[model samples]
Target chain A: MLMEKSAVENGFIIDLSSIKNTSQLVFELSSIMEHPDVKGKNICLKLGSLDLKQSQLLSIKALIESMNAKIAFIDTKSEQTEASAVSLGIMIKEISSDLTADIAPSEEDFKDSEYKEEAVEERTENPVQDTNSQEIVEVHTEVHNNPIETTEGIEDIYDEVSAQELSEVIPSENYQPDGFGILAASEGLLPEETSKYILLDTGNVLPEGVEENSVNTESMQTLYINQTLRSGQTISYDGNVFIIGDAHPGSEIIAGGDITVWGILGGIAHAGCNGNITSKVRALKLNAIQLRIAGLYARRNDTLNVPYVQKTNEFTPEEALIEDGKIVIYKKLRRD
Target chain B: MTGRVIVITSGKGGVGKTTTSANIGTALAKSGYKVVLIDTDLGLRNLDLLLGLENRIVYTIVDVIEERCKLRQALVKDKKNPNLQLLAAAQTRDKTAVNAEQLKEICDTLKEENDFVLVDCPAGIEQGFQNAVAGASEAIVVTTPEMSAIRDADRIIGLLATKEEITSVKLLLNRVRPNLIKSNEMMSVDDVVGILEIPLVGIIPEDAGIITSTNKGEPIVNDENALAGKAYRNVAERILGEEVPFLDLDEPKGFMAKIKNAIAKLKVKV
Candidate 1:
């Protein structure tokens, strides 16, 4: 006889192969039931190998029940063994060659059992299955290999259905409204009262006739360089760039997003290289010979025409951004 | 005693690495310690000239490394201090003539006899720098207040930090203009030390005496009256595990000297 054991959540498996006699089967079953690991867990018996008489099947079921534990079995190909298992009140779990079958029990099998009557009632109460099942399928595929995830999906569906049925089963006349009026009053002030005033204050809310643009915006990643970018060094990134040290004259940095330098920046910096016109560059000391953002370029000789409050001859911290299709430099306001 | 081999390196040229090496070697020798100065600039040797021993060179470092002459025979004795010596680099040979392993071997043999071995490294972070720092246990990075020199000095400090043999690295801010620093135009010694994040070994002010001493084929440390001379002497003492306070660069001279000069002027007027 061939025997194999596998452990499942709150359950254990016993696969029997080519048992010769009733005595051998009894000894194996008793030894497994007495196992420390299998003592409290439900038993799943694979009966594909053992073709036994009706009396022998009843005896095994009775022996399992005597241990105060529930037992389920994968039905054998033989009609005699399958009928014997169903007649004896033993669960004949749907058999599949795939191991995932043990985790994902078929819905039909779940509805057939008298033990799952509550689950069937719950499913009948809830009509919104499309959205719920779609989410379940997503979660199931993400963790396809985890047996716990499969079991959790089944339990979630059952819980949702059961909860709906429980609400329906209660009489509506007996139900009392307890503080629900206050909760509804509080929720009513949420969207209409607060958001309406916020939109009014901004004065730039989109008109009702205008549909909001659904632009796909990717999250921008930032690359940080902790050391100075010396001459002959170049750093290129697909996202925002931040340099903690100086970018010397001969060095260059090209980024698809905005760039910020904590120290002196006297090099060539090209931001919004992927054609993002709104991208800007900021540095503690802006002495760059050339600055490029999107299609626009700004040279050091380009005088900043803005009305200045305090202008210094030395290279002070400033910000460069695209304005009217041209790059403009503005002195950074001290936050302190 | 097994002496320390300190490498003097500045990633940028004209930062006074040769001058600092020569002065520190002289100051250490003046303190009665036998010191050997090595000019590892290879093709651009200047340490011998700074030590005023260029004409007395019979063999160079390349000859010793190539096994053409004994290491002892290649050592040129200093005229000012008998305890100080110089191993000049070959003016014709490039840096490739001497490898890191050979330099380390030479430094190891020299350490057994000398109290200190100072190697004057060449500019740039190339083969020359690597060969100079190969056997050094300590490093002194000379940097001026200028952004370019300080940037290169920071890079050299980064490279030296990666070497396993370099146990310590210090900064020597050279050519600092006191008036510019007071006016907040030039970087102060504290600013240079803060950017470099290394211990300040010494700070040599922008002294014209340094140039005059080099012209006279003498290290400024030999001139007791020069501020730069006292700075070099203090650096040499600091290297020997002595704790000396940094000099005040704001004043033209020491407080006592300024008072004495003022009193002397008053006496002359009377």
Candidate 2:
């Protein structure tokens, strides 16, 4: 409803002003660019008042080019997103609010929506794309979530605990006994999320001379395997990786696109290893020791090391992605 | 064939690390595997003593690393078992005498000819521990049920995780007193495993025979009647990828022991 499209004689505009996060914006734009007619056409983007890092903006540019298309320019309301576009060398043409009503297309090559691109957002406002093919991949964000590292096994063995426990907080059974003493500590319970993982301070883990880019994850080839990844075994692939079994602790999985696991994912998983900002990692039971997305790396909280997890049938499917320059995991996967 | 290099390490001193190394090495050799036990404790070497091969050692590991003798010359063949050998540590030199790279080179060479290279690490996580671990791709962390030992094992486990080459880090609980655990005086196997969060390799019961074996320069695993020996043998089998049930420490077999246990229980009740 926030979009309008009036297809002028030339290239079109994509207005993504309503999207809340960079990942959603890129995900939606990539789906639209998958249209057959959209290939080879220069596109204009109307990115709303969302803050974007230089890496994020560059990834959006890469996503468009990956579809055989290009972004001619972009208009943004937020100074942060605008600054990112400028630093990335993307041209920014401001489409003023006053000029929206004054500019009308007398001849409609494509028409739909309330109002769309600036000539472009004005086009998306008139979205004639229903007659054409416009399938935008929707990323529905579910707000409520249980504890972070929630495992479902207490019912199988204990029998008394029926429900999936809210993020279980494990205290570090570690302490410095003396000047050089350990093997004992006072176990104190603490709030999760803040205690579970400390973001590794290694600055800009992306390789030197490498820029962040989002290759349409759906376009990349997916490697499928059914095996429990053991310690010391590493699976590194250039495309999406789909594991049908558990990734045990000490094992590592690195992929260029998304990482999806069918069972418990307890090892280190690096999704979008090539720095694609829109890539995600989802698992049936996601209690990974370390979660890495694009350029961000987070270690499992040392206090959360008590892995009393048993492999049972019940699963609390979880997903992890990058948001606000940090790795945020959502509990339930929502579809619309 | 490339042999597997396994390091047996315990952070706290006197946690049966040397005893576990000697027994497991002997047991592996008994299973017909060509095993070489590397005493990496350096200044405080004891694997040779436990194997009763200290007197037979003509050249130590330092001699080989320093290029004074060949690796073959330094490997002391066991008096009884030709399949088992010991690369005795230099008692005269300190831990600083050997670097990690030199130890890794020695391990690489020995592993080329042997089936299993078990490195007996020093007590602490110092130069000796690093030198021992540099050669190993697998690790067996030995710990007792004592709070101090379990704590130190946790620290050692964390340290082992940092090494990229060392893949499998398993736990071996030593000197587990079943009677004490029954009386709630000591931590049980479950408690230790829950705290450590690693797969158990084996659990050796506290046997007075280990003391005699250590004094006589013999591994307890060589004693057929010793429960500790059977436990060590089972550990070797498990390492070979055979699934073996853990020994129930409470179950004492045979008529004589059964009668003695019954009488002791009756006396306690009276």
Candidate 3:
């Protein structure tokens, strides 16, 4: 994922423009920092529109510093990262066009077309740069939209990266009011926490004597709970279970039918534990550590580092169900 | 040599038990000792990820207990240090898969060849914790500067008292923000030690470097200039029966300190 390694006057340029998520960026950046050539050298980071929290940016800065190297400056299109860099006293200087022109990474290296198109537009504004990048610059501007939607391919990306990064980006791009895609797969790729739930290799994690069956859950009695489920607390029902408050991590909810949580579900939710394949788990914020449906069990991805503290209060509701023997999550866009 | 098996445990979760285990284990190994770190947080393992040895794990403690793989094969060597090895916990199996007797047997075998066997116990005093403490004679109860963590650590110390095999149980206060303590916003190390009523082993400052080191899959103890790393190294020396003083956690704000830090970095580079 690290391309365009160039040595500057007294430093090295580790262009992390290709990688999208923070974890992958750090994962790759730390690996690059381990190389003897990059050690103790002033490092210039070209971060293309990756929104990072001040704490996250500070950790990146510390990671660079711990390697006995210093970050001379960073080039980013993200205001959050810029604010973070300013607060941390790290310099925010855009790599000069002349410096980048000599070792510019190809346009295809970018994962987000929205940001890549802007970078291309910058080259288009400057016609005097070089004849080499003019052709590639013209090609990027033509196809402005890149994959308007990420459909039936989340489980695909999970097949490529290692288990530590084994995750599918949440289908957030599909929440575009079912219209012209406002953003390509860019916004959904932030934070490197795409896969909210990863399938556990444990075969048939259901309790003993429970068999897989897709019964009509609507006919079953529903257990309603109003209090928040804390750690180690458990709620088990032979039918459906609906919770009005949040289910914190370490709590367990097992239902024979469907499980609906009005608040954030951050615990383990097992729907149709008695074996109803049609049973689904829905929550205002489906951040369950383990999502279980029928006999299939999927734990939260190891790298799903959701910032516990954020300014925005927006939470897109989500639903998880069994589709073709795989637990596929669908974005539940509110009609209101 | 019969290596001392020390279980790093905290009754409460998110109190940095695994982080302490990884760091102390790494620090001990760096001091020219044969160290074997065992992660017993089955189905929720993280020790491998912190050490950046996740990809190298071919088998786990479950595989060793079940005889699916020999104990020697389950030991994944660290990337930078051959003296540091890890026996990862199985991510697919729950805590019930292994019992206390089985864990003790594994620890006994591991202690014969290694100088230190650090068991990273999972949260809660359930079967997982029992299995972790089964084979250990020494314990380090890790806690943060919070009432909840201290309360849990107290309970853990009480539980460790009932074990005939456990000879020592020391408290290692983690995430001690000295500035916050100075302003009376957070608990001080003395207060924590008073409540827990255990011998002090180490006091780790809340450093942002830990977060980066965790994500990088390298322990902070590897970074010689990191204060947290230096504190962990001191903890290892204490484990080896050295009389080391605790670090002064006052936030360094002097210009002279800056020059000293810069000079230290320059020395490390050279």
Candidate 4:
């Protein structure tokens, strides 16, 4: 019975101490801590010689501050909490022995035991309540406390697998092989959490002011791709493309307006792509290929000598744009 | 249970899609899930032939969609498993013979009674593949380790991603040869996963039993002792959301295969 009392008291203490690294751990602790009977008893914290890092120490400090509890950190070499607690009881007796010896029969020795017993009685009398809701609130509170820390926590609230995190660990979940992470509870911090996906981080991956194009905007006239775009490559523009990218022989591209490929712009290319194209197609490297510009159609011209841009030792970003209703091509100036 | 409709598709042909669908359906049926395998191959109706149920199909899916017969009348029971059924396609029909809306409607009706509806998508990213995948809440893209197959799977995955309707699609690698994998002669599962970059549903070993089963109109997954059979069952379990660990494709050969291969190597050395 005395041991049961201590178990209840210790469980509550663990719940109140908010120094856990994982949400699962916090949940398990909260259930025990929120027990009314356990809360009523005096809880003891045996701070052994644990090498806790700053974050853990801070979290513990936060929990102690929240609960308004008295805690003393000791650097004892002992690993056993129960034995240390007993030793602590003895040490308290020795320190106060001279003063308390003349008073009521040793309240210090009985105090810890009485607190433990009361905690146990309270546990036995109370019914089990779901502490999951309390755990979630604690999780939010913890995240709110340290807005910068990203480590072991409720990795996901739903069965511990955030859909976004699930997407990352199992790359198959999100189907993005070129390095992508999932955004579980899409609080939109997902874009911020995964560094690799931050494609345009201010000082990182993407350089500053590299604004991504608005593909769906009405002003986005057309994309004129003139070079072979390889697999895993993406190019979006506000104007028409002249040609390129493996737009492999059978592939096609969609443009908001007229598209003209100077290379073997094969595959599917749409000018006035998405029906916005005052779209037309003119290809120098045109192999007789499928073409679509707005509602217009141009069959593959087998005789068309679409200029095949042969590989050279130079870095040439050949691109095309429309000026005054005609397709023009040139190499882009080096931004660097 | 309100059955889940799953479509098995590969954008390119010769990717073992039909074979994978057949095996997975058989495995799920064996697991006691009321399964209905729909052959969406249209004119190239081979799933029935793969299962050796070609002769049993009296009313093809074409007949039901065309209103020649009722959906119930068109379903052919798998002689092997009472819980498994087949909705065969028309031999004379093309992909346009059935529309995506029609297939979705058919799947909705089947989902009410069955625990799982497995659609065998025809090869090519044309209308047939679209029709088959239309109703499927989940999709499995079967591919070999070759770059060509991986490329096609990637395209299909991209399409699925852009599609607002279809929610989930997974990858299943078939015909993996462990011997070639160990010798760096073949693409490892990791290589394929890295390239296509989708959650892996299963990695089926290159088992001769698969060919033999195909020749005999038997599903490789029906052989209780076969490795590919176990692999398909693992895929089925994963579809049910069980965390089944993938088979270690790179593990050293078993004693039996090692001894046999050693003798073969000796012969080559001589």
TM per model? 0.43, 0.43, 0.51, 0.42
Interface RMSD of 1: 43.0
lDDT of 2 by residue, B41-97 (tens): 876777876776543454578888888767887787886789999998876568999
* lDDT at residue A242 of model 1 (Cα atoms): 95
DockQ of each: 0.01, 0.01, 0.09, 0.02
Candidate 4: deviation at residue A278, Å? 68
lDDT tens string, model 3, B107-145?
999999999999999999999999999999999999999
Q: Candidate 3: where is the Cα deviation over 4 Å?
A: A1-24, A27-45, A48-193, A307-313, A334-336, B1-3, B8-19, B25-134, B140-225, B233-270
Residues B98-202 of candidate 4: C-alpha lDDT, one tens digit per residue: 999999999999999999999999888889878988888888999998989889899889877766667888999988988888899988889999988788989
RMSD in angstroms, all models? Answer: 35.1, 28.5, 14.0, 26.8
Q: Is the docking of candidate 1 incorrect, acceptable, medium or high quality?
A: incorrect
Worst 10 residues of 2 chain A by lDDT: A135-144
Residues A192-308, candidate 4, lDDT per residue (tens digit)?
Answer: 222111111111111134332224333445444546754223343446665644455324355554555554444445455454434445454333233443433333221121223
Given the true complex, what DockQ would model 2 score?
0.01
Candidate whose TM-score is highest: 3
lDDT of each: 0.65, 0.70, 0.73, 0.54
Best by lDDT: 3
How far residue B208's Cα lies from its native spot in candidate 3, in Å, is 5.5
lDDT of 4: 0.54
Regions of model 1 farther than 4 Å from truth: A1-336, B253-270
Tell me how many clashing residue pairs each candidate has. Answer: 1, 30, 1, 50
